[model samples]
Target: MRKGFLKNRFVRVKLPALLFATVTVNRGLMR
Candidate 1:
């Protein structure tokens, strides 16, 4: 129960930011 709630929160915020940062870094490397 508690784990599920934290997982949802992570997906809502942390996951997107993490993915965005990774993408940006990849783009920078591509340059």
Candidate 2:
């Protein structure tokens, strides 16, 4: 149960970071 909770937290953190990075790259390309 503890491991599952940690995995969920990791995914939550990682997903946003990944999304932010993608958006920044896309914006840079558009400019």
Candidate 3:
């Protein structure tokens, strides 16, 4: 359970960066 909690926290930390990267890629492709 503790391991899963740490994994979830790691994802929560990374999710925004991933999202931002994807959005930037899409915008670049659109241009």
Against the true structure, whose TM-score is highest?
A: 2
Highest lDDT among the candidates is held by which one?
A: 2
Error of 3 at 15 (Å): 0.9
Measured against the true structure, the TM-scores of the candidates, in listed sequence, are: 0.64, 0.84, 0.68
Query: Which run of 10 residues does model 1 get worst, by summed lDDT?
Result: 1-10
Model 3, stretches more than 4 Å misplaced? none
User: Tens-digit lDDT track for model 2 on 1-31?
Assistant: 5999999999999999999999999999999
Candidate 1 wrong stretches, greater than 4 Å: 1-7
Better of 1 and 3 by lDDT: 3
lDDT of each: 0.93, 0.98, 0.98
Question: lDDT: which is higher, 1 or 2?
Answer: 2
Q: How much lDDT does candidate 2 score? A: 0.98
Query: RMSD, each candidate, Å?
Result: 2.0, 1.3, 1.9
lDDT string for model 3 (1-31, tens) is 6999999999999999999999999999999
**Ranking by lDDT, best first?**
2, 3, 1
Clashing pairs in 2: none
State the weakest 10-residue window (summed lDDT) of model 2.
1-10
